[model samples]
Target chain A: MTTSPPLLPLQLSDVVFEAGGKRLIKDLNCRFEAGPPSVIIGPNGAGKSLFLKLCHGMLAPMQGQVTWNDPDAVSARLNQAMVFQRPVMLRRSVSANIHYPLKLRKVGKAERVRRTEEALALAGLGRLRDHPARVLSFGEQQKLAVARAWALKPQVLFLDEPTASLDPAATHAVEELIRAIHAQGAKIIMTTHDLSQAKRIADEILFLFRGRLLERAPAAQFFEQPQNDLAQAFVKGELLWWKLGKANRKRRD
Target chain B: MDDFGDAIRAALNLLVSLDADLMEIVGLSLYVSLVAIFFACLIGLPLGAAIALFKFPGRKLFAVILNALMGLPPVVVGLIVYLLLSRSGPFGVFGLLYTPTAMIIAQVILVTPIIAALTRQVIEDLWLEYRDQLLSLGANTTTALPTLLWDGRFSLITAVLAGFGRASAEVGAVMIVGGNIDHVTRVMTTAIALEVSKGDLALALGLGIILLSLSVSVNGAVYAIKDAAQRRHA
Candidate 1:
């Protein structure tokens, strides 16, 4: 197995966010080491997705900076890609949809075609390249979304509930695609309501509640013993966990 | 009444015979409407996209003006264009009044705001729908504005086609500005009106039929595009 080069992927300094006269994320700080995949597990409205957006540079931090780093220096990089829960497909064919960002970045014809094919292969979507992305089953579209991001060869990948709407078989397919992406050397940070998914895919987990980070720990430890009461309640299904554990327990046992 | 029927037959005969004057009128009307619609799109699309995305201090006022202009009476638009191009008006030094140029000006003014306001509405809906995703993508404000507009191209195409349909069918403004000069400025609508007023029913009816067919074709194309976009989006 190839190991990724050691590098710090992200650092979040005292970040604050206030919207609609309410504080969504209050004075939070975090640092993820260079090589391990991290998962953000939280209840709905807990700002897990929001924090991902902040890290991806989608939203301006009200108080602090989320910086990407390499051993040489800590600076922001443009080579990061993100996938939303509901994939936004262009009103175009599947091939054209995958070709969009590559076209934007001006990847040459031969290179684009090759990269796209490799991405499709990685996502197990080789046969559906010509199919209209919008017409694909939701699971297939989400896989295509991952394929689209993988084609970018991003340094860090942020997924905001990438499988929230999938069935079991489909969810497994997507999770596998994510693993494939991580194997290819992209550092992965994902937000999910599913603790089992976190346990399955995440090396580390960050737990959040009501727009705040309650705890961050290894995935095995987070599931085995969450540090905070809210995290405990969330894992046990007392909190509105968006049915994450319910699906996991039914499928796993 | 019988005379009117006879005139209709006569006009049909003239059309089948390829009457030069009737063909000239058709050509002139198409030329003018196409130019006006093109200019309307050039000005309207960007303005509409901008107004839909930005929130400046005077945004409400600008939106109100555009919305009000969408309903501005055709004759009022004609009168305004006429005054501006007339000998006594400010730009009268160019002496463009009662010309096809003046007619184009009138049509462009009459239709640009209608297209802009409608396009604005379409793009605004798209902005609301995609703003969060776009922001999450790290898109800046100016980039998001055009990106949202591009995402909603299906509806924007419809807006442009609507502008063309309106410009082609509108008569009050063009007639006043062009003076409907025979073989020169007389287009389908103005010619239809002139021929009818002169008891030349054949020419008027023939022009009306052609006008309806043209409108139908424009609308047909718009519908085809919408259907294709819908299928792909689905």
Candidate 2:
């Protein structure tokens, strides 16, 4: 008999994070259903990235607990990996770098070779396997970072602006990889400053504004009709996000 | 001055001839320093990494201690070690006085802190860049330590080379503890001192050239490794 997976793979209850006498994330409660992927979108300083980190257990909430439905079923630490905007590449061969996490997990030699090749192939880095990871172009390096995480087959993947620094072509490549990874059954949770990217990859969007998760809705609905004023003005580029949106409009014209 | 020129010619001739005494001293210096560096790395590397990675009480105090130890006077260390291994001292039972083993002990003590302190700096620098990525990947402190070390391998090699250079060239500590016994405890640095004091400029000059060459080679190796690393990283 086959066992069915739980409906909600991730849950955060009244999560709060404060740093340096400032409330960064205040009392956030959210649940991620094990269906379509989730996206987190916000203006600069919206705490969107911080919230993604909290959900991935990278940052501990000051006043809440994050519970996984099957905490015992999988290693929480091992079941998720995040790709940061600026990736860290070890001073090693590309293949060796890609195989790093697998080596740490002590996967067998043959299996590591097989999976490393698979990851490189998926990331379009098959030819440069022998090249040093650091020597790869920035776009290639970012791809390597995603491939590195993808190699682990993490059940829940957290991506903090994986495409923020990429050009359009590189952004497309990364988005495609994200989609392929999501297709493999791992839930994708990402944060982005680019609304277009949010529109492209997000099935659902969590709109964060000034440390508050103001609204959560489907991706199409979030852009079509942001429930909160901050989010609404943000979608239309009418609010000041960087300079409080007023300056953003001035710069826009 | 003529003697000095004669010594240089003689030393070059000896090196060309592969002089047995010089070879033995060179071989011994390499072996003892190597063993000392190995032990230092095995112990000091982890210690430094811990000092950098963890936030225990007195950590700043420990850092101060290591920094002080890095500049520790070798002669004082030698005297302390000499006294400890003397007949009336507690470790006299081992009969280690004036032996190569005593020299090794002194060298290890002198070099370990250097290795530890330098490695700590390297690892600490890397911690800024990598700690988050590794943690996000779910690597605990235990797992991250090794990964950090491996990633920072180039820097660690320079640390080890620095330790080796210090251990090999140090005369004061190894001399007092080793007693400069010919054919046994007599290494390059101590032999140079004895030969120079006895007005035997040829031998002293020869050994000096060897020591300088050794230093050059070690430094060259460090640079070559660094360059290779940069090329790979590029």
- Local accuracy of candidate 1 as per-residue lDDT tens digits, A189-227: 999988788889999989887777889988888888986
**lDDT tens digits by residue: candidate 2, B1-234:** 887787788779878999898888888788778888889999989988888888899998998899789988999989999899998999999999989899988888999999999988998999999988887765667888888888788788888988988998999998899988888988889889999899888878877987888878878987897887777786
Candidate 2 Cα misplacement greater than 4 A, ranges: A1-7, A239-253, B1-7, B201-203
Best by DockQ: 2
B219 in model 1: Cα distance from truth in Å? 1.1
Query: What is the Cα-based lDDT of residue A25 in candidate 2?
Result: 89
Indicate the worst ten consecutive residues by lDDT in candidate 2 chain B.
Answer: B135-144
| Two-chain DockQ for each candidate model | 0.40, 0.72
Report the C-alpha lDDT of model 2 over A1-253, residue by residue, as the tens digit. 8543442468888988999999998888988877678998887888988887887777788999888876553466667788998989888889998788887878899999999999999999999999998888889999999999999878788898998878999999999999999999888999998988888888999988888888999999888887766677788886453454445456656
Candidate 2 reaches a DockQ of 0.72
Rate residue A231 of model 2 by lDDT: 75
